[model samples]
Target: MTEITADRVGGDWLSAPRAQAVFAALADQGFAAYAVGGCVRNALLGAPVEDLDIATEARPEETVAAVEAAGLKAVPTGADHGTITVVSEGEGFEVTTFRADVETDGRHARVRFSKTLEEDARRRDFTINALYARPDGQVIAPLGAGQLEDLAARRVRFIGDAEARIREDYLRILRYFRFAAWYGDPEAGFDPEALAAIAAEGAGLTRLSKERVGAEMKKLLSAPDPAPALGAMAQSGALARVLPGAVSESLAPLIHLEGQAGSGPEPLRRLAALGVRADVDLRLSKAEQKHLARLWEAVDSGAGPAALGYRFGEALARDALLLRAAALGMPLDPEALSEATHGARQSFPVSARDLMPERQGAEIGAALAELEARWIASGFTLDRAALLANLRKK
Candidate 1:
């Protein structure tokens, strides 16, 4: 494998003083250190790289000492797992020692730190994730055959034997689908070997913690368009095991409607689009749960934008309307979308105080409720005096 130089990376962050300092500090200590995995992959794809993780031949202690010697803070965030978080100029980068798994219980692995980059690369989940790049601008593809080609094609491939990789860590199963959704070019097709492994080892997914599974599902759903990757998961039976009741068929059209509305990636909206509800493993927040409840209710009742927005608030109502629009193949109405986003914020003029004293206790409640219903019926146009007059007549 040849070293891809810094010029190739081209991103300002790649050569930023903070990033280069990480590489220089480790190199000065005679350790082979390079920005590895997602950082390298995203940089290659010209995407914005968030975290700058480094793979090195140095041990955890050596890494900590090096970063501290370089006038930075070193935190052993995952020392037992061969990871040290090095903080430089307020930016933290994970510097993990090269490691190979000695034994695995599917959830956690017992790894032995090593000096070879190839060993570290081999242990990685995917080929695109295994590329390592030095600050000096050299990239290495150690164990992944055809890795460079696969990466160029935006192909998400499991490294080595797919089943063996899954056995090492069941979490990779979800990661595979997520990476496919985020990075893979669907037109190029998916790997059959990977799909087969997922189906065969589908049972292992239950062994993973709910938080882990839920986190991956959230990221997968948040993709710009997860339809194709989700379609593959649905076909492979993986989706059923993970989400049991999730309906993926509506996702494709739903995504199209979202795009038409110029919407960005939203996890809850995507999940609502599928019209799935369950006590499955995915951990969603209380607010998310409440919104989905209202979303489906509006979706099922075929509520118009105004009603949806009024009940669920503009953002959620807008998403629900778009999901319904996509499901029904109705043309996306910009005015309706705008209405769903802004028009539902109606304020009725009638209040309990206006009907109070005249109608006491339950009668007052009934009067206020009746007037409010009439106000809603009139698109919230009726004023306090009109409702009071109507209340007196009633």
Candidate 2:
């Protein structure tokens, strides 16, 4: 009975020619197709719809044949899992056959393709994500009793029993917090039942792959304000379960500092603010690991913002300053921020080449290091000639 206005669902992505073509192909083949999950949920919430996913009564092979018959390309991207990527006009849309979970073992699920939309909706994680919309913007009412209300209230609740849902996939424990951070209402607070279920299932988190946990953490940290959700995770014991010794207290201050500094969410920086060694629990890229290591190094070095900027560049310097300020519960220094910007643009005037001849081999590197320290200590005011004059004195 719930319906989204045509105007709301009529965004460019939904109405694009290619999208309509895919819908038409499924309709012509007499398979009931509806834009499902995040696409429908985000559209109704007036949030950005990143991907268009369609759930159909058509079997995977049938879905494939229908798209190809319509002169569109069908790639069996997840064919074994009842999904096919239907390509039209160079854009790909994930077209999946409706499924019902047959068996689940905390990490993976074996699903059976089902013809009923109700079955498909029931198997989804959250109530809000179970709503569906037709190509023409007619939204099929969610089968769950309070789902529509949950969506309107900005509440992210697991479908059916929370513990049952979590047991189906331990990763849902982290996903619960991630979704809460991104989509749930911070003021409303998280659902107590969900939090309790998560707490009871905390041990299941250890079974999830580090990469999956890392990806979820990155998304959670990238939210506009993740502090409230993170605090909830800590309370539910899920935070400690995933990241031992991680604390959420400093994150709020860091977020406030970021706002004052006009910096958007930086997941790695926020993760650093948590003050845990994530390199062990999370699978970070080499570049991310190095950047994280440098943030900690800069913090421990007791380096001024200017020095941090000079050594790590402006962006990192700002992160270090913000993290340091948050740790100390102090307001950011405006002058220090300006100095960071200034220092990032400064180039050291004392390279090894400048120390060559007078200083050779290992001595050249040693001399350059000494002079660069003096140059930076001088607030970078000493030019090449002024710095080289120190060598003459020595």
Candidate 3:
């Protein structure tokens, strides 16, 4: 088992002035405060921590007062839920008081403020995530004695009853698969109870808004080895119900292809690999949908550099080609990629203005475009004068 020391948890976020201030304020108010949840779990794993969350024993009102007194801006983002967003120097830290779930609807939880770390840990999802680190560098583990053991064991066991936890929030069903994809060990396989609970609550996922489901699903599919989770979803019949896509029979090669392509992380290509339609209103904006549509076209057309440059922008064309290579399970040929990128960057040999005497207006533009296409087809060998000559002949 991998043991996490206090030094392992020290990073930019934990050491930030704002975060220190919040800790100091809560300490001064006689409240126990600590960084908890994914932040702590990710810290131990050396993963990038995007958000810092602090759980305190102080009440919401007291927490706000202490934050304001510490010269920080506190917004009552979820006062009823004992949570607030505290801003310091333009960065936001989500501060939530220790709370226990009073009631749950398998989608939303009604939580009540608590004063003990144990109560707070009891309300969380997974054992690894429930571990906490105090400001004094002491780790507080309430879920079980061996939080690090469970994490290293590659287990996704719940803090308590898997069914009760899944009942608290159906999104946990998807989160289970997502977290597993990113962190679980493939050799260990999914826990049977966790899998069964996820399957049972999968249909409740339909109750979630498309925007929420879309976000989670996209993240899930973007993982380094999303195939396992996707395959599990397909086997459990979850993808067909929540997502508007076909769960492909073969996704392992596509996942491996994604790792090979190494392109920018646009979830659309991954989603498309799952046989999803980009233009569907899965809660994307008109502009976003249009861009996805263009991406789809560029990937599907199998167009060369010139064709892609005209259809999509030069950069997008390169991205489309890379994603296309991934989807097709073809190795990313460095020579081909380099040639395409260089070709996309090269300027056309001639423009319509150069054909002023022979061809005029839109026809001149059309002629020049055709000449450029020929020049590109000839591997950029045709000179400007030759392109103009070709245009004139046409």
Candidate 4:
């Protein structure tokens, strides 16, 4: 395989002084280094590249020394995994040594350092991602026969042995579906061997961490056609094995609806469609857990502005309606979404003091609650005088 050089990246991402420094430092040290992985693939697809990863035949120690010699800060982000975080100026890039997996436990791999480019490319997940470019704009593609052909065809083919690759890491099962949703050609159907591998190794998914699973699940659910991929997950029994009670045969429509409704990609909406409670030990952060709880409460209540407005603050209430709108595949009542938001912004028209000496303490609190309820009941149309009159009647 040929490596991507500085010229192929349109000289934009690699134009940064740090990027040049990294390449020059590695080259000066007699090590072959190239910007690899997603950045290379994105450049090919004309997409915006965010992170640039470098792969070298150099060992971790050598790579670190070379980077530091170039006046960059080198951090041992994952030294055992042959990775070093190189920081230049204000930008940080991850550089990893070329490796071949020697041992696999279906979740983690034990890899051996490799000096050959073929050894490195052969270990990747998909074909479209295997192309490497050189600094002078030369693409060294050794993806023989049907591989590059498959990529141009938009087909997601496992690198070598599908079952063997899947056994190395069951997480690839979900990644396959994600890639399909994001990049596959509708004409090129899902690979049978890949699907079979996922079904057979579905049980291994439970061994993975919830945090990893949650991140991948979020990406899968956020895809344009999450229904088909999610349906595949359920059909393969991967969903049941990983999420236990989260597999719902009826979740496809809800996922489809949420995709159409178009909100920020909050995975909880998809999680809810699976019929699983938010309390599952999914390893979500306290803030994430709390946010989901608020959205769930608002959806379950199905009440008018004041009720929803009082229970859930404005932002969360809107999120709930958006979630419902997505699940229902219908537009929310512009009025309802806006009204809840507007009501949440307003203060009580008449506080206890504004009601004068007639109402105070428990009586005052009771009157306020009743007036608020009436204001909500009257389609939130009750004015200040009407609210005061209702409070007086109490």
Candidate 5:
């Protein structure tokens, strides 16, 4: 019976024509449907609603038939799991039948579609995500007695027993911290019982796929401020379980440096700040791995900011400088940072083509290399004419 005021939840998304049409179609079939999960939670919190999901009393095939009868396309996105993607006005809405877990193995769950909202709510990982909103904007909380309070307090508490929830799907271990970073109050801290549960089940993280682990880590690090969550993860031993040798000590300072530089969160940069070899543990894409490797090299090269920018481009140069500053426990130099941007903008001014014929073959490359060094040393102020003149002197 928890109520979210209409003003708080009212928006075009709440009454979108297509979403309303889907609800009408379900109602016509005497099947109840309500917007559920993240869509409802975010709408109540005044956050952007990215995806629209609905939970229904109808079975998966019943949902498909109802939508199809209404001239809407039904996609069996997860039909075996009671989820059907109903397409209306060219937008896809995930319509899932209410389900309860029948069995769990820490990685996968066998669920049975249920007839009641309470059963659906109880199977959810966190209370904040278990909320539902009728198409008319009536909010429903059928699980935790404190579900609404937890959402209002910005707490990410597991439904029922924390350990039991973790045992159901160990990925919830990482998800707990990820949600904390994005939604939980850092000052209020994490739920102690949840932390205890996570610490006890820390080893379950290894049972997850590397891609899933990497994805959760990236999302966690992308939060506006992830240091507090990371610190907690370290204390709970979850950080080491996924990324051995990773520490949270330097992350706060790196975040401070990023803010000072007016930069937004960059996962790989923060990951670099952790001083762990992500490639060894995370399933990062080839491009990401290569970029991370370059970042490490830049930090260790002792190269000046401008040189870094010239070599790695502006964005990566800034990341390297920030990582280097965080590692050294030094404040970032504004002048040095500006110089990096300047270097990224600057061309070599003297390519091998300029030196071709004047010095043929390997000698041309050697001469350009020497000239480029002198040019970089001159703060990139040395023009092509000056560099060529210096080459002539050699």
Candidate 6:
């Protein structure tokens, strides 16, 4: 029963009215209830908690009744799996009965409800994620897992046997890298045993759904510095197992360049930096694939910032230039950055509407494009009249 000072993880989000009411309702039902899993883990790490879940001794139906009795909505988000989402004051808190996995088939688990917290903790994938917290911020850490200590050290380890955990759910292979990228300490480095286990089970990643792999990859690539974790993945053959042609070398410079430019990392851009066709390997959305395509086109165009901005709009043009600079190992030129900013703000002087009857159909379209190109060549300083004059001459 290790205790924690929740106030140290201080933020108004933790003490919100809805989270408090949900916890109180569960406790009032005469059950051992506490905020559990990722919420507690993130709170301890002083990271932003996205969701709040309550683990309780009460059964799912009882949990639903208790929540509804408290004037909140009980949604059976995963009721069959012992989870009932209790909506309090419009915010949803997942209230689940403590359960242990009776069976698993590498992709899904068959869990049986239990009153014991130890079984709940044992069934979890990682020790750091099994922590529980009372409303007042007192954490309940089961003995022997070293969850509290590992979290403090920023260590991410499978709860028991790493291979057994991986066998229970193959997704843990990618999750291991994702968590390592997000939270693992570069100083303490990675756990050797965990790495060895991941190396052995790396091939199992092929069994996962493309969507699951994509989501995890997207998040992992979004990390501020995912290079180290990715490098380890490469060394363990996990990265190649997941994405054959993808490499980590390109990501390293892009991260440094982003930091040097005081810009945040863009996951899509990072994905492009990996030099792979994400549309084929990862389950990226059409919009994401399009964004990557545009980013690649921008990088390959070798166009100046002004031209990039004119073609890609301001925000994307700036990002493209930044990536280009990083790839070239050159300091971001103030002149190029200014040109991109200015170009983004600059509008093309010629429009098809302006050439209506004078130039119709393909001719009109071609002439407008030609004039716009001339205007772009002249630093976008050419006026509509100048563009029209050029169009007329041509």
Write down the worst ten-residue block by lDDT for model 6.
1-10
- Model 1, poorest ten-residue lDDT window? 1-10
The reply for model 1, stretches above 4 Å from the true place, is 1-7, 300-302
**Which of the two candidates, 3 or 6, achieves a greater TM-score against the reference?**
6
- lDDT leaderboard ranking: 5, 2, 1, 6, 3, 4
Candidate 1 per-residue C-alpha lDDT over 323-393 given as tens digits, one digit per residue, 9 for 90 to 100: 87777877688888777765477876777777767777898777777777687677667888888888788
1-394: candidate 4 lDDT, tens digit per residue = 2232332455567667767788788888899887776676667666688887888888999999998887888999999999998888778888889899999998999999989888888888877677666554345554664554665566777888888888898888888878876667644567888788888888788888888887787787677556666666777777777677776544555554445445445567667666655857677778878777777888888876555765687766666666566566565676766777776776656667766687668987887777777776776677899788766674
Residues 169-243, candidate 6: write the lDDT tens digits: 998988888898888887779989899999898878888898888899889998989988989988999888778
lDDT of 1 at 393: 82
What's the CA RMSD of model 2 in angstroms? Answer: 2.2
TM-score of 6: 0.91
Q: Lowest-scoring 10 consecutive residues by lDDT in candidate 5?
A: 1-10
Question: Per-residue CA lDDT of candidate 2, range 1-394, in tens?
Answer: 2343443365877888999999999999999899988887888878899999999999999998898999999999999999999999999999999999999999999999999999999899988889888898777765854777787778999998999999999999888888888888898999988998998888999999999999999999999999999999999998888788899999999999999999999999999889864496699999989989987887788888888889888988888899999999999988889999998999987677676677789998778888888888999999999888867887
- Model 1 clash pairs are 3-138, 3-139, 4-137, 4-138, 4-139, 5-137, 6-137
Q: Whose lDDT is higher: candidate 2's or candidate 6's?
A: 2
Q: State TM-scores per candidate.
A: 0.94, 0.96, 0.88, 0.87, 0.96, 0.91
The order of the candidates by TM-score, greatest first, is: 5, 2, 1, 6, 3, 4
The candidate, 1 or 5, that scores higher on lDDT is 5
Greater-lDDT candidate between 2 and 5: 5
TM-score of 3: 0.88
Candidate 4, poorest ten consecutive residues by summed lDDT? 1-10
> Which candidate ranks first by lDDT, i.e. highest?
5
Question: Candidate 3 lDDT, tens digit per residue, 162-271?
Answer: 88888888778788888888888777888888888777777787788777777787788778777787788777777777765676544666566545656544566667
Pairs clashing in candidate 3?
none
Score residue 146 of candidate 5 by CA lDDT: 80
* Residue pairs with clashing backbones, model 5: none
